[model samples]
Structure formats: C-alpha cells, structure tokens
Target: MSTAVKHDDFQLPVMSGYAKESYDLCKAHKLSFQRCAKCKTFRQPPRPLCNKCHSFETEWAPVKGTGKLYAWTIPMNPIGKAWVSYMPYVAAIVELDEGPRMATWVTDVPHDQLKLNMPVKVWYDDLTSEVTVAKFKPA
Candidate 1:
C-alpha cells in the first residue's frame, strides 16, 4: 500500500553520479555537457565513456545556451499527480548548437505558436534548495 502526495508536490530527478554533476553546473546557470576530451564530442545525460572513441576522459564544457527546437508536444494528460497542474505544457527536444540534443521544457510561449526549428535559449529553474533544472524558451 502507498499514500499519494499532494498534487503541488513536484517530482524531481534523483541527483547522483554523472547526473548530479550536470545539475550542479545548471544550478550555476551554466548549461554544460560532458565533452569527450579526445574527440571533443559533447554528450547529454552525462556518461562515463564516450560512445565514439570509448574515451573515459571528459570535461564539463559550457554551451552558448542557444538551440533550435527540434520537436515538441503538448501533453494534455498529466503523466503523474505532480504534473496535473502543468498539463498542456510544452515538452520539447532542443538541439544545441554544440551538436547534442536535450529533453527539456519550453515555456513562456503559447502552445499554438511553437514551430519546428524555432530558436530557443536555456533558462534555469531553481526547483529546490539543492536542485536546479535547465529549461528552454523562445530566443
């Protein structure tokens, strides 16, 4: 048996390991990705080894915080209780100028006005005392 939390209780990702490092950077308002030192390729969802060169050496490199909206969707149905209030929000895939694409929220614009390949910029939301999420907005 389980109990449900309030709808206002937002669910956040668990910050640990490689993911924690990424969020830590975002907490500082710096949108960065794990870049392979050998090949200079940037990657999202920070990982231990490079998929291209299998290199273990990586650096947290900041991006220009600009990207294009590759795709998006408005979820009319909440995925969870925490998202009930955020229904109809834009869930988007942003392709960064640096080559890697990230899943993020695109806010501050009407749902009907969103266009494919529209310019977007990164923004940080301080969700909690220790967590900050990186989102996007029209640029």
Candidate 2:
C-alpha cells in the first residue's frame, strides 16, 4: 500500500486529486489546463475553484503547446543527487498561447541563448508509465 515511487534515487510525486488529473492528460501526450467553465479562464496547477470567478466547474482544455519563454534560470547546482548530472539545466516558465504559464525544463537550448519572450514548444518525457512530464524547447 505504499505510494512512494523511486527512480535512481529520485522520488516521484504520488499522483492524486487534481495533480493526478493533470498528469493523466500529460500521459496521453496532450498538454492541457483546467479552464474555468464559468469564467473561461485557463489555469495552470489545476484547482477545484476558479481564481477569477470562484466557480467550482472546470474542464481540461488542451492547448497548442506553443508559447513564449516567460522567464528562466540556469541552476548551477543540483538540488538532489539525482540531478547532479543535470546541473546547469534551464528551468523555465513558459507562457502558453492560451495564456497560462507553466514551469518546465527547457531542453536542447543553451542557457546563454535564451531570451525572455522567445518562442518555445512543449515536449513530453515519459518518466514512468503513469508519469509523463512536460518540457519545452525552442520553437
């Protein structure tokens, strides 16, 4: 009955509630956001209530996965041993075309060349059968 998941000393999140719903969409290779059915506002980090109108109704709306690089930082150090090999990686915030911003790894692009508002697109990485994470790259 343990929900803990480990991969090379890195522990994955136990998917549940809204998080599990979000990751489930990623598992299907569809980048989605919870759109407030009342206000039509899309939000990242899915929640049961809408931030705009405080509506409890929402829907999983898929996006084009194309966006602009909102912000980023090159982490010079690893937070965990599992990320030691990935030091100096780009941690970025991507503003999706529909308007929500999501934190993701920006791959295949040098950190020196990254600029605010640069176009990026979503890509999927299957960390496990039930967990598919989204990353981004230069569009």
Candidate 3:
C-alpha cells in the first residue's frame, strides 16, 4: 500500500514537541516565539536556535492574527459522523502574518465556496475545556 495520507487522523496537524511554545503563546493571549535575536527572523515550532542563520538568541513578539490562504482542501468525510454536526467543514493552511503557516478549520462560511488566496483572520474555537485552537474565516 502507498504511504500516502489516506486516513482522517493525518489531516489535523498541529505544532507539537518543539512547537509546544507556539501553542502556549496562543493560550497566554500573546503570539510569541523565539525569533533569532541575531537575524531577527521569526521561527515557528519554537526552538533554541534559528533555522536559517542558526542563531541561538530569540524572544517573543506579538502577531497580527491575519494571514492569506496558502492552500487548503475540504474533507468529504470529516473525522467522525458526529463531527458531521460541524459538517461541510474546511481545512486550510493559513499563512499567518508572521510568516509561519498553521493548519486550521475555516468557520462561519459555506464549505464549497472556500476560495484560494482569500484573506483571513484567526478566531479561537474553545472546544476543549482547557485549550482553544485557532480557526479562520473571511476577514
């Protein structure tokens, strides 16, 4: 069998491990991450150093919650039938203003009409009792 992304479980990709700091920032109401103090370039999936310049110095900065639709797809069959309650959903790659791309669901709009390169802004969906994930919609 091909090792392609055939399962629904593979659809929802989030920053884990090295990127935990990214998730933490959203929870704190401050979008932050280690930007190479030397290069001043923003780093995603936060790390002790930079990906381009390999500089170890970094800090947190605010992000504007706005981005463009980098790429996306609509899942015909969402995770579970129950998820169909929130059916006709859209999964997208939103390139945040900070230059890092994040995966999210596009809400408050019809699924079929989702457009490419459309402008969008972040909105948190607090489905979990503890944490809220970022979703996007037309700006």
For residues 24-133, could you state the per-residue lDDT of candidate 1 as single tens digits?
Answer: 99889898999999998776767888899999999999999999999988888877777766676788899998888998888988877889999999888777778887
In model 1, which regions exceed 4 Å deviation? Answer: 1-8
Per-model TM-score versus the true fold: 0.89, 0.89, 0.73
* Candidates sorted by TM-score, best first: 2, 1, 3
Candidate 2's residue-wise lDDT over 75-118, tens digit each? 77768887766667788899999999998888887667889999
lDDT pick, better of 2 and 3 = 2
lDDT of 3 by residue, 1-139 (tens): 1011223433242647645566666666565555778888887656787888988888776678888888887766866754554545677888887787777777766656668888898776544333446777889
Runs of candidate 3 with Cα error greater than 4 angstroms are 1-18, 80-82
